[model samples]
Target: MTYQRLAYDDAATPEQMHADCRVVTALLRPAPSIRFEDYPREVVKPTLEISEAAARLATALHLHLD
Candidate 1:
């Protein structure tokens, strides 16, 4: 038996890339010195989206995920 490698292309417009960057940065920023039991719910979608985008970009750039 032989195995064939799958291929994928990851490309994004400059505007989209910038937007993703901003989203990730905002999520990673230090939180305010306030009491909070949980993170904001609104940021969940953007945070996941940015994470996926970054993973794809890293793969496209031939970066090792490990």
Candidate 2:
């Protein structure tokens, strides 16, 4: 993330100030623009299938069973 210094003129209006504040907020911590359709497909499982399979095999062998 890059930090930018904002400058406002003395004649800045309420609307301009509000816009500048929004810009600053975005620069400091941008809001997520993800759509609903994309979020459901996100990977929720913490471990991959390969890791789970290896873990199961290790458990069956009683070698460092989790």
TM-score top scorer: 1
Model 2, CA-based lDDT: 0.78
Off by over 4 Å in 1: 1-6, 30-66
Instruction: Give residue 18's error in model 2 in angstroms.
Output: 0.2
The list of candidate 2 runs beyond 4 A from truth reads 1-9, 29-66
TM-score of each: 0.32, 0.29
For residues 1-66, what per-residue lDDT tens digits would candidate 2 score against the true structure? 998776964578999999999998888966686888757766676864458778888888887843
- Residue 60 of model 1, lDDT score: 98
True-structure RMSD, every candidate: 25.7, 11.7
Tell how far residue 15 is off in model 1, in angstroms: 0.6
The clash tally of candidate 2 reads 0
Candidate 1: the clashing residue pairs are none
Q: For candidate 1, what is the lDDT?
A: 0.76
